[model samples]
Target: MEDGMGFWNLRNFNLAMLAKQGWRMIQGNDSLLYKCFKGRYFPRSSFLDAKESLGCSYVWRSLLAALPILRSGYCWRVGNGSSISVLGDKWIPNHPTNKVLHPINELADEMAVSELIDSKLHVWRSGTIMSLFHKEDADAITKIPLSRRVVPDSIS
Candidate 1:
């Protein structure tokens, strides 16, 4: 394997001599080594695209354009540009069942996750009980006058 200086000089020479003159050169073995160092996500497919995109002429232009975006850390995010539905913690399926019957909280180590799980279960039970008595639910209870409210220790 070439040292960093060796790779740097190679890229320097390739970019300066070939690319600057509108000629393209995609060094296959070198690029494999380069990507291995860089943690490229889609290596094989990206390699194929790079091969075609950087074919024997004018391909360096795209690299020039791509450099800034790469430097700025502007890669696509997971939920980006898609019509996927967003769901929150309240949509947890077992919430209603767990609320009706308290479960072992020791299954979770983190206080936030465990406490939130317990709270959801309690909320579910409260709503169920309220419904049985034809009474307004906790969401309705939330809108009651602040002066008459009793807040939890965590909230205060």
Candidate 2:
């Protein structure tokens, strides 16, 4: 692929493609919905509108909204108070903001991408870490792995 494509791009493109077919992601910032990912978990900052990005699981929340299922239905976001909620026919937090991560989330820090790379663990969740690419419009970039059946000629 080109030089850059992250999980976010993979997910956004996946969702957008699905939306075009009529399926959609869910609309709430429900912690339950987030629990679906293998290493996914709620970050402590979910309780606050924090500036720190790039690593927090909030990206997962954003990705969920970018999912084919949710994106076709409703957009997910934070609402009044400290609630993680959705805006639709009616506005509401899917659940109480007091929702905390399961104890497993604590143990998960070690499994983060940074920790894996630092530990010299060559295997990421599955693939090898090759490059980091950040782009303004992911769809405009055709080098993305998810975009092709075979790994891009450049990387392979």
Candidate 3:
């Protein structure tokens, strides 16, 4: 390769296609495939949380294998932040990890993004964010603009 980069080869291409399928399944919940997977594997949880189970279908296993790839590339567009976790979910847009990377200060990992959002105003609580995260993280958090219109958090 001119740049010393390796080719995508068959394995990489297969994984990429699988990851794309997983992405589609996440984004298009109305699809029958998504509905089937949800009912069988992740009935009470999100697709990202689904784990391998005994006697699972080959397709489900393949999709599960590609989840890590999907996660590394996906970012959640914060809405009300009700469904997103402050420390766990990937909500920060430009940050490398796409998550709150600073040490937690009196904040639980499972805390909802809504906790940092002013629901009435649909804006991030800057003071609260600053109080909780380090300067760099706080700045990153503030840079993620909020939409005044109400919408559910979606993958980007």
Output the number of the lDDT-best candidate: 3
Write model 1 residue lDDT over 5-66, tens digit each, in one string: 65556555554453322211122334543455224322453322343232333443444434
The deviation in Å at residue 145 for candidate 1 is 32
Alpha-carbon runs more than 4 Å astray in model 3: 1-8
Q: Give the clashing residue pairs of candidate 1, or none.
A: 99-121
- For each candidate, the alpha-carbon lDDT, in order, equals 0.29, 0.29, 0.88
The digit string of per-residue lDDT tens for model 2 on 38-139 reads 223434432112233456565454553443343323422221111222111111123222122122222332232222122232222122222221231111
Per-model TM-score, in order, reads 0.16, 0.19, 0.90
Rate residue 132 of model 2 by lDDT. 22
Q: What's the number of clashes in each of the models?
A: 1, 8, 0
Range of the 10 consecutive residues with the lowest summed lDDT in candidate 2: 147-156
Better-scoring candidate (lDDT), 2 or 3: 3
If the candidates were sorted by their TM-score against the true structure, best first, what order would they fall in? 3, 2, 1
Per-residue alpha-carbon lDDT of candidate 3 for residues 1-156, written as tens digits (9 for 90 to 100): 123475547667778899999989889999999999999999998888789999999989988989999878888998889889888888899887898777676888789988989999888899998889999999998988889898999989
| Reference-based TM-score, model 3 | 0.90
Q: Which regions of candidate 2 are displaced past 4 Å?
A: 1-13, 17-33, 36-52, 56-72, 75-156
What's the lDDT for candidate 1?
0.29
Score residue 54 of candidate 3 by CA lDDT.
99
